[model samples]
Structure formats: C-alpha cells, structure tokens
Target: MDLIRRLFTAALVAGVLSGTAASVVQQATTVPLILEAEKYEVVTPPPATAAPTTTAPAASHAEGHQHGPVREVGEGVPVTLDEAMQRIGLTIAANLIAGVAYALLLAAAILLAGRPVDARRGLVWGMGGFVAVSLAPSFGLAPELPGMAGAELELRQLWWLSAAAGAGVGIAALAFARNRLVIAVAILAAALPHLIGAPHPESAEGAVPAELAARFVTASLGSAALFWAILGSVCGWLMSGVVEPAESRPALRVQPGAR
Candidate 1:
C-alpha cells in the first residue's frame, strides 16, 4: 500500500509537469497547423449519380480525406472563445493523462531493474522512449494533417507496435548485452522495420500545404522530445526523493582498535 501510494504520487507529479510542457509546446507549434489544415476539410461530395432521392448533405467527405476521429475545427469563420476553450482544455487533459501514464511505466521499469532513479537516468529512459515510440515510427508515418490519406488503421497500428517492440528489444541489447555479435543483432533488429518499409496508401495527398505539414511534423517531434525529457527528469527526481539515496546512508565509521 505504501509503495502503491508513493508510485501514484510520483506519477501524478511527473505527469502534470511533462504533460503541461508537451501541451504548451504543441499548442505553440502544431495546433495552428492543424487549424490551417481543417480549413480544407469542408469537402463537397461526389455528384450523386445513383438516385435523385439522395438525402445526403450537399457537403460530404473530401476525396483525399482519410476517415478518422481527429477533430477538425478550422472553418472560414473566426473561432469562438468557447470553442477555443474547449479545444485547449481537451488538449491539456490529454497531455496530463499521457504524461502520468508514461511516468508510471518508467517508474515501474526503473524499480524493476533495481537501479537508482535519478534525473540523469530518467532522462535516458525518457529519450529512449521517445526514440522507440515516436522517432522510429515517424520515420515512416510522420505526422498527418486534416484530409491526409493513409493506409488502413490496422496496418499502421500493427507496424507501429512491431516497430516499437523491435526498437525496444534492439535498444535493450545495445544497452545491456556487451558482445559485438549482440550489438550487431541489435543494429539489425532496430533497422528491420525500416528495411521492410511502412505501409502506405496508393496515393500520397493532403489539403494542407507542404510547408505547413513539414513545420507541424517538426514541431510535433520537438514537443514529444520535450515531453519525454521532462517525464524522465521529473519522475527520476521524485522517485529519488521518495527513496533514500545510497550515498546518503550512514557510512560505517570504525573507531581505532574497535576490531
């Protein structure tokens, strides 16, 4: 119970800090690009050749738009305060939740390894996570804007999970296994996904400007980097504080002739 409580407490603090930082940076960088892309989401449906009784709205999904749950807000008109608040609030909430989850996972892994959790080690874990979860996957997927078409969700999800798992294993080998043969295998393991290539739709098209898309991609990566770094640092520091440091333990002071 005490362990659980401490872990939760640490997670709460780490999550709040990491999530807020990621959200703010994302807002500053990626949010605007998403808004800009949404302006193009008002697609007119293909002419109804089938029936005159068609009750479908005059506007339907754009040809290039991939169906998904990502919210599209940028219309021609200015955004209302309420709408802005809602979006911002939702973003904040998402960040907080994600941050907490990542922190909890990191803390558990650290404790499991019987290693000291400190800011430096946390930073490494966090960065490794970013590499495994974001950087490697993005090499193929990148970030998509509204109306961007892609391969089926299942395919993407499968590849992503496999890639992450592979990267994790490869990294573990690189970090822990000392043999040259092990390192070679690790390199191959990490490179395998890229070698096979990520699945993509037949067409590569989107309504968003190339420049804006590029910016958003860069910003998203940057924000993720920031999030992981903060999570590691905060979680590490918090956990270290919660547990007594090894060096801080009272050293055995032997008196002369005590033996």
Candidate 2:
C-alpha cells in the first residue's frame, strides 16, 4: 500500500512539473504581433471666391483674401499603434476563451466517466475536452442560413490552419505525458477549429478581397487551435494528481495450506 501510494504521488508530481515547464516554454516562445502603417490621401474643397455686384466693381475694391479647403493627403491607409494593439487584444481574448471552454469540457468528460479522479485522469479529461470541442464541429453538421456568408467565409479562411496547429500541439503534449487520452485530445483539438469554421465574411460581394481574407482566416484559426491544444494539455497534466482512482483494493497474498 505504501509503495502504491508513493508511486501515485510521484506520478502527480512529475506530471505537474512537466506541465509547468511546458507552459513556461510556450509563453516564452509566443510570437509577437508586428505592426505596419499604410498611407492614404484626403481631398480638400477649393477656396471660396467673392465678386463685386456692380458692373464697374468700384475700380477693384481693396484686394480680398480667399482661403482654400484644407486637405490631408497620403498614399495608402494609415494605422496607429493603438489600432494594432486593439486587434491583437481581440484575437488573444478570443483564443483564451476558446481554450478555457475546451478545458472545461474535458474535465466534465472525465467526471462523467466515473473514473477515480486523479491528476492523470484530469489530464486525460482536459485533452479529451480539447479534442471534442475542437474536432466535433468539422462534420458539416453546423447550421446554415442564406445570410451567413461572412461567417462562412471566415470559417473557410481560418479553420484549416487552426486544426493543423491544434493537432501538432496535441501530439506534443501526448508525447510529453505518455498518455493516450492526451494524444487523442491533441489530435482532435488540432482539427477542431477547421471543423467548426470561423466567423463568415460580411458579404458575398468581395467585402474582404477573397485572397487576403482567406490567408488571414487560415492563419488565425490554425494559430488559435494550436494554442488551445497546448494549453489544455499542460493544464490537464498539472491537475492530474488531484484525481483519485474509482476503485481501491488490497493486494492479495496466500500462505501455505491457504485455500
């Protein structure tokens, strides 16, 4: 019994330590957002002119001054640092929320399975949740409507990348933990975003300029999927120790002449 207890404790400790290390590495390696500015031009109105009413005009009354409309001109679009920050913030927030949701779902699954709650099971549940939430949406079973063009387009643009990233991260986590549940979770989580699709574009009439929009969506989804998969795996592994097994029994031994 003591030996078993020690083994369980060691598993919990190792899992947690590994998870923490992975998280630190992830944060350290996160890609930073780069901002670039584009220029644009603004047209100004012409200056106002005043003319004398009389035919002679009183020999050209005192010279009058006229001011033309002030216009600001630039070559392309101009974006400020603040604008870039806001966009990055929105993207980060969205991914964080999605990740949290995935983790919660996994926890619920482990609980539902009636397994002895332990760090390992928690890790499994977490990975499982990531997979289910991320991958389940890809079945083309999602609802459809005529006016949802924008949303549809967004999904097409982002889902593939997201799914791929998620799968990679999931695989990494599984390998690190040596857990089947974790592996499964990684695969599913990586694939989930593509399955669900991103928010559609606003119009079918070229609102986002097809090619650019597609690339953006694909990159965004892929990055998000990978981020969440890694997050789920780490968190799950960290919490694995807390769960207890469902059944407990004493080791059996027989003595001479014992039936």
Best by lDDT: 1
The lDDT of each candidate is 0.81, 0.45
lDDT (Cα, tens digit) per residue for candidate 2, span 1-259? 6534543444344434434433343333332211111122234465445963554444433323244334343344445889756855664554445455544444444434444545444455444443444443333223222212335455554664465467546655654557788777777776666556555545545222344434433443344345444554554454454445545545577999988
Q: Predicted candidate 2: what Cα RMSD to the true structure?
A: 12.6
Q: Positional deviation of 128 in candidate 1, in angstroms? A: 1.0
Instruction: Note the clash tally of each candidate.
Output: 0, 37
- Runs of candidate 2 with Cα error greater than 4 angstroms are 1-77, 116-131, 135-203, 207-209, 246-259
- TM-scores of the candidates are 0.79, 0.39
Clash pairs (backbone) in predicted model 1: none
The lDDT of model 1 is 0.81
